[model samples]
Target: MDQKMFCYQCEQTAGCAGCTGNAGVCGKKADTAHLQDELTGALIGLARAADGNHPTGTTHRAMIEGLFTTVTNVSFDNEALQRQIRIVHQEKEALIPRCGSCESRCGRNEDYDMRMLWTDQEDVRSLKSLILFGLRGMAAYAYHALVLGYMDEEVNQFFYQGLFAVGEDWSMEELLPVVLKTGEINLKCMALLDEANTKTYGVPKPTVVPLTVEKGPFIVISGHDLKDLKLLLEQTKDKGINIYTHGEMLPAHAYPELKAYPHLKGNFGTAWQNQQKEFADLPAPVLFTTNCLMPPKESYADRVFTTEVVAYPGILHIGEDKDFTPVIKKALALGGFREDTVFRGINGGTQVTTGFGHGTILSVADQVVEAVKSGAIRHFFLVAGCDGARPGRNYYTEFVKQAPPDTVILTLACGKYRFHDLDLGCIKGLPRLMDMGQCNDAYSAIRVAAALSEAFGCEVNDLPLSMVLSWYEQKAVCILLTLLHLGIKNIRLGPTLPAFISENVLNYLVENYGIAPITTPEADLKQLLGEA
Candidate 1:
């Protein structure tokens, strides 16, 4: 409470303790952080109000909306946070109509003071943070599925249950199960999303996306919403505006529904962290559909448009109508690169491949199994998670590079941008480095791991696969929890351990699950391969 604000939910938090100064490393200000906490507190109250009542669809959506807004880099507008807070309070009031007029009132349903959680006993805070952050991440996937008209009663209900638990005066024992259940429930959530996406857009197929900005106006879309991209693609079809995926949207190029748009030319830049430099003086408008949006610099500020839960103070926002006219006009006026301009990924390659989803991978299960049996494939590495601007992220690049040729690297999310362009060649005709769609497609990895386990007659952990993950924000938290819930151990996480994990809680992970912070790539690779 004494500091300007408190935020340590991200990997890049100040000093690996907390970000309590004027701004977080993500470029979010103290005031915005404070507003986000207030919004979270209001959501806790909403969940508390729904404790004994059957929450309506409206209530379910409000819970998802409010939680996703607080995700690390999602919403930076104080007014937007205030607006979401008002909606949360209204939903809570609807859930308990006369709670406001209680004559002898108890404060059971009042908005929580987030400072309590931030200032709680360390271990208790750690457990609650896991549940809360995990819920926040799961909410994002839920929101995406919701837009595509997919709903799971269990997933919707867990959001309320998770929020209520966060507000309770409970011991660590009471909260720990909820922490892992957050993972259990998220598996369902991720599956629901995978179903929604694959059903709406036919299962993704392997495709190569170029990094060139063709000579014409183009709009760059960042973040994780495929619905938004589909709508934008439909709107811009044959309009002379080329659509380019950026950041997490890079995986969009692999989906049949999205890739069918010829104007959906290719990917534009690298991960979200590089946007400030990538978008500066750009000749096209950039649209952000979800998180990982940094504060825009003055140079590119006018061209940044946001939609859904993503909002910046002054950026033009495309609302529910999904109209992309402003974006189209801006692109035309700028008249993108007068000539076809070539761009390269971080590794200097002009193109990258994606869409090796569970469907595709499982289709060739026989071949993969044969490869492993014949010693053509030696190991499997799932190098996936959100990418950030941290210097230590170079570990992922090096990890992928040093992976033995006989091993297959399965990656998803923006982390692939680090070495996405690298040609790791193939093992027994299966690309050694396979991209299994977006971070949401972690389900693909889970499915493949399960299928492999079945084929090999062993536990997934007993398989040759090792998870080397890097995280930046909330979605990563939920996915990691899902991994733990599945009892899959020996995950190597970096660039740093989460700041909210108390020493005791961290030890619990290490002691029981073998969760370890990443060390040097040489050391980790050797140890994972039994060469150490």
Candidate 2:
């Protein structure tokens, strides 16, 4: 079939092959998709140029920004994408200013067209897609850390290596290792971001956030950037406006310095997918700090503000200055609800608890070990990742709701919104359901799992821990790769496998890692419990 565009970088691709229609499933137009491909090709060229030179901080930042611009739902404006392409080209020129005018032009430094990778054999395409998409996700995490004054040489260099590999004429034998290496490096990237966050903001603690919106003007801050949320909170302080967290930003309520702001109220909406409906005719403005931004509806489009790397065609973006005055004005102008408006989570509960990062959990590690030994905690289920708009996503809610009384639920990202408010009673002295911060905080889960394995004198997979994950975007891609890279096995991934994974690649994963797409929660629960 002839198509204007080809994209399978997201979970919502068409027909589980690629988005080859006039518009992608995520509302990306053909022109925008083509521009994104161009932008990616330009980034590969930049990586190619950086091969022999020592890339400066500016080079690394540009590469990260360019990769992140191509992530799904991050940038929809063709003009913005074209601008990114120009920036990449400028970086490449700065790295090798004489390459363009060389007498004997060697094609080694030329930009690689993405169509070549897209049209390769299925397995090759799948492996390259894994590397490309994983790099995109890791770039976002690295960008966050860079903003907070943290940068890792290894993590920064991997961007160039991975991107260069994507453009290489390498077979599966060569590319496969690089694909796995993407996961290996992403682990470092996530850890860097974790260090930046916990150091910038204090270590997170168990904090209960309300779903109720008190009467007053309020701005709902969404996405996963704590730095952005903190700046907004500071700017809006004592301005007679309340700040509410949304989507992945819900965990922001647990940060000590952020929670200190009295006007920083509770969570507002659910996950990112629910924004269109939830933000419709809302009295206050909504500010997006990162990805999972759906196209704003006309109803509330005027009140939507984007900051940092997130951009839409007409949305007002708060620049690097971190000034949030426009968002505040919009919030004050809307003049929120006449009285207090109470909102409940999907499970019909009024409050959800967050924090519970590695620091908090490890602080009580002895108690957790004792509870397990005493049989009060039978198992640990990490039901985490981004929340999607698919029909079966409620499987997470059901899985958490039906977990055995003796088991504990550790969750992260917006997926926890499915059951975050459920009043699952405690085991020993800890709440059965623990929110482990945002998707980036998957590092915390890894740390805790490693510590638990050391405490039990067994491999991580040998422990009574299960990973039941739901992925919606590229961030989830990098996190899943990190899990695979660590040799963690028996992972259950769903509500649907990525369309980009060819059947052969899926088989390789299944046969080697025992990764299975989730079925019914009851059946999977039985299998995970060794009863199937």
Residue-wise C-alpha lDDT for candidate 2, range 164-201, written one tens digit per residue: 88998889899989988999999999999998998888
Q: Could you give the C-alpha RMSD of every candidate to the true structure, in order shown? A: 1.7, 1.8
Query: Which tens-of-lDDT digit does each residue in 189-211 have in candidate 1?
Result: 99999999999988989999999
Which lDDT value does model 1 have at 201?
89
Pairs of residues clashing in candidate 1: none
- The per-residue C-alpha lDDT of model 1 at residue 298 equals 97
Please list the residue runs of candidate 2 whose C-alpha ends up more than 4 Å from where it truly belongs after superposition: 1-3, 100-107
lDDT of each: 0.91, 0.89
